[model samples]
Target: MQEPIRQSYEAAKELYAQHGIDVDQVLRELEKLKISVHCWQGDDVRGFLFQDQALTGGISVTGNYPGAARTPNELRSDLEKAFSLIPGKHKVNLHAIYADTEEKPELDELEPRHFQRWVDWARERGLGLDFNPTCFSHEMSKDGLTLSHPDPAVRRFWIDHCKASRRIGAYFGEQLGQTCVTNVWVPDGYKDTPADRMAPRKRLKASLDEVFAEKLDPSHHLDAVESKLFGLGSEAYTVGSHEFYMGYAIQNHKMICLDAGHFHPTEVISNKLSSLALYTSGILLHVSRPMRWDSDHVVVMDDELLDIGRELVRSRLLDTTHIGLDFFDASINRVAAWVIGTRNTIKALLRAMLEPVEALKKAELDGDFTTRLALTEEFKSYPFGAVWDYYCDKSGVPVRENWLAEVKTYEQNVLLKRGSRASIVN
Candidate 1:
């Protein structure tokens, strides 16, 4: 998937090297011309247990990773006690400890008072609070029962959780002019063995049926199941569009939210899943950029967009909101690194944005998305224009050949006084 593009870039690199082109200057120009992708999601550490991987260093992943992520005071005050500067905005999407885990030790082992404040807390800061009620095969679930688990008692437990979750989501929506979306990813597939779900499938269907039948409301939310592969030789059929399209086939209002990286690992340009999702009358997409190497390191949409944008636009599945920074920084200095990586990624995307919309129009007549044409590096880099060229073109500005030399001199003489990684990250 990344091979062809990397190869093309390599060829260009060689051509420039042969011509003795100044790479550093070229890179700086590229960096200066970019835009931030979303600039939200804090894309760093302190948000998740893991380090922000895009930065210096990161923690490694292990199976069944766990954390009881506490937010006794929004993790803000506690964080202030640890660091000199504030991290990015403290955002929450449902794992708020004070909200759900607050102890009451009363009915169902907790009182309603314990669960009541998340609505206001989330509203005050304007974070879209979200969570999945159907627990996976972990200690969190009653006997590890997902929606599909058979024991009626366990099923009842699952139902109760969804009911409560829906209410919480809805309360916020009703009060805040928003909607709480429940992202349901049924982790009910089999392990590496002969698989049969004749009985379990029935239970699974019943579980979702109960969800739509009894657990939904105007404020409550439900998105489609998370798309994933099946184990061993079996194909995942839980919501296979052809066979079950449980979320899409039916016309009930629930929509499909495609994780950018959830589709095929080997990048094949199909219509953008979001576009396809929109065609299925779904919107409210989850926006993490895709990577041919890993799903989680969501960095650039242009990389993904170039591969699938035209079809995605053609599919017209939905419009994009702020592209979600669905990545985890598994590295040191998780915060600043997230910002830097985002800056780099956005720069790359802005480079693409610099591309004229006219290209798409020409491509429409051409019938092929990838008909090759000679594109100058400046055109590719400065969707706006060549760094100096743009200033000249739009603002009637001019640059001398010694411009780089002059800028470097001033930056060192003055700007270099600015100190520390803290300035960069914070």
Candidate 2:
């Protein structure tokens, strides 16, 4: 609505027009894209299930940042604040551990009522909800094993937990009238070398089969399995390795989640999308940044992220790919982290949408590698920022870096007050 922004957007529109790219069309498409924001980031994976317990299952949040949400209401409020600053309609991804209840219900006993509050909250905002079974940070996962544990009792407990979670996911989807993707990710592995790797994987496959024995309607719920190369404790052998999950997903006709930080340091998920899409029904992307490990750092508009957005658009897999953010940075303002990551993700997708894909593909098909490379390089300097700002303006979100001011004000007035309350209670 600002005069300068409108003028800049007009100039950028003209520039893109020269390249046969419609900035308006790109903006329209970008508006339709939705990225599910992870709830764990707001609380650093510290769910309300056990207030005194430390983070378990080879996961840890580094910073002792203040204003971490301690209750369902607080977390939802914080999420609303973050969503207000980011453009576009988005969804919220919840872990089973985040059940809004006063009594500590056993994993196997968890039902749809535990999440009724979440459903009500999301419905009020016209937002969809995704879910994950909390396979970590509990006594069941103390040994870094759950579904693949050698003990039948331990494995059965986790299976029941997963099954219960699926039912909850179905409830979410049925109430919201949108399919909820309930992903399974267990920290089942060995700290050192294992005498028998195949045995654990076999056990895992059997466990999954039992958990997914009863199929829910696809319209209400979708199942996805996540794999990690290694983790803090399971460095030597991760039972649910990428190869294992890929094979299992393909054989069972399930969605495979490809996390950006769940692979070798040099490997990227963007290149894997095309190949995997050919076999799988769809993909669930856990977009995150890795600092030499699965650190789950806040995302930025980096090259890898841009490549991911480009691949999703270029391959025409946007409809098949379920995009969601997966990161938890306790070092900075949590609301700002959400706003920055979600906005940057939208920005990357918008930039990819603005590309002249038809021209580049034509050059490639005509065997004009030189022309293709030239066109690709030239797009790097396009006025994508202006279009992004225009889109933000239209969405009623802060344009450029203006959102940072709102976050700082919120930290001073709202977040700091929580610290004061804790001190008073102590």
Candidate 3:
């Protein structure tokens, strides 16, 4: 540590101790902290080592084949790989039960089929399956807004998605003896300026209002209302910040689903996001660095990395169950993104949570951005050049092609296992 940082550490230590914080205990949680990733369909389960006890396997649409028609054997084998590779106790984000299967004409009573598969998958694993609505799709949301959309067709599609999902979620809860964790991440905003901002936001409010007032089935579901900003690549809108509630989603529609990466282009901090939804008492956070506009560089070279992370975790503003990894890999090796991003998030969370809570208290009480900057500088006295060099170094990942083979074997076992030895739970 540099001379200045060593002094800050001393001060931070004393302040933290004053608040009855135990550094060692907090550090242990950090070490055990595993990140959450989804199980995409094309992924190889054996490529990554997932020994960490706290990591979660997110069942994301991008990761899993939610839209495909699979035999029970195929589904079971795919899930078995997920179970074998990912830590069992971790969570899975259900993007939805039935993906965009409208194009497939051979299907009938679609809801029952997917629900049956989902229930079977859940029963064998004894795992909790969480659902996140596939919002902002081209079909159901031509103009967007589950609650606020002017078009009746768009709004009705959302209702069907919710109603069908709730029924399935309830079934899973009863069959698996686990509640469905539902998150509404449906996109409902504009690409350009609208005549009224609240107009679009109000739609979210209405749907949330419906969830809050009716259509809640505990046997099948638990609610966490998720929202996010429109990408700049898309068109711009006034209520598009994703941080501001607009109207319906928070007060009327559903509970809060806060994703920190959702705020990067806006440059909002973690504390601000937590504060907004902290009152809802239903904050489900999606944690990740959004590397947009070159601002969300997820390196630890500066306080921008730890500044907000420390603030949020230290304040206990977030429940551990509410956090998940939301990182994106512009690179080829996806697992590396989960590893490095989780490592950074865990490290920051520990330093902030385990250290003296008052470490930043003095800086804030001092009430000067410059002083806070200096203190952060002292805390992070690592050589700048070294940090940059390390980030620039692309870690190598060995490529594999056996994921399809494994999927095929799993398909035969789960769907067509006449002579195969694969067990349902195995």
Candidate 4:
């Protein structure tokens, strides 16, 4: 460690000790916390399954950033670089469209063998894997409805795809010895006000029931359903609204995914955690930065992000919560986007873990709001940076913005060379 960093950590450790916060324990807990990084960010959600498919389902990657990964190996290589720059081991979240098979299998025909390379890659790094069934950006979803489409043939295709995805998720868990969260987030909604919304929702619920009919081992595979308020085209009505999924998750005993960008601009997932934790079995958080709409900008260390971490730590919901990042900015260096967002997420959680939660809770319980407020504000200026730097140093990652230099070097040497190979959209 650098001498200055070592000295700063020593001083910060002593300062946190005065507030009854064990810095060592905080770091240890942080070390164990894993943030699942989404593979879509590396290639702007353009998975390897389809070559000519434009991003449908209200999903669009802005900017024609050079060197976006075109193949499975390139994406994995980029992910490796991003993982190296971030602290701690984490899981890799994959979509069904990211299958790495030589055979051109239909979505419904997809099997675990198609994603064997991903499992092998994850196993080699001792990282867990999470999965999603890609229900958008396909020929079947041209009308912007999936799973809830009125046509049974269309609905059956998506249902089978989701079932196949769950099996792949179970295979990941069984092979890696970690529970794989197979989350379902479909873009089944209408652009205009529907004459009948209830029918679509009912169809969706029934479709989901059939999709999850074959129960997988809970120890290996866990199911989660995601909800959205609105999307680019589906601004009028979204079938899987929060209320709908919240009720469904409670009834079906499944995890409900809360994407930060998938709600009203005024609503924050941090506030929903405590209330939902009371009824839901588990939560899958897709942390993102939404600028007014569902424009998935890269996550930053903003107030909402900090509060999300605070809620998880404060409410003791860390164990039941599965945190995954969901943002794709093709405008920036894709690998750097991953590093920046994942590191900030860790920082947010670390900041919360470093808090004197017990004392704060006691003050709240005793009606000492002033003390609680004062301490909360005061800790913001505390030596959190020192401890964070130390943690990064110990984890063998660059501290602060220093990681940017490595990303720049990678761009010059590795990323730029792949520009010709990258599939740039517009």
In order of appearance, the predictions have TM-scores of: 0.57, 0.97, 0.60, 0.98
Misplaced by over 4 Å in model 2 are 420-426
TM-score top scorer: 4
Candidate 4 C-alpha lDDT tens digits along 179-220: 999999998888899999899999999999999999899999
Whole-model lDDT, candidate 1?
0.40
TM-score of 3: 0.60
Model 3: per-residue lDDT, tens digit, 374-402? 65555554332222222222111111222
TM-score of 1: 0.57
- lDDT at position 245, candidate 2: 94
| Model 4 worst lDDT window (10 residues) | 417-426
Q: Clashes in model 2: which pairs?
A: none
lDDT value for candidate 2? 0.91
Q: What's every prediction's RMSD, in angstroms? A: 12.1, 1.5, 10.8, 1.5
| Per-residue lDDT of candidate 1, residues 26-108 (tens digit) | 54434332121221122222322111212111112212112211233423322222121211222234421224442433111
Candidate achieving higher TM-score, 1 or 3: 3
The positional error of residue 423 in candidate 1, measured at the CA in angstroms, is 30
Q: lDDT per model, in order?
A: 0.40, 0.91, 0.47, 0.93
Off by over 4 Å in 1: 1-92, 95-101, 104-118, 140-145, 214-222, 230-251, 267-270, 287-295, 298-302, 305-325, 336-354, 366-379, 383-426
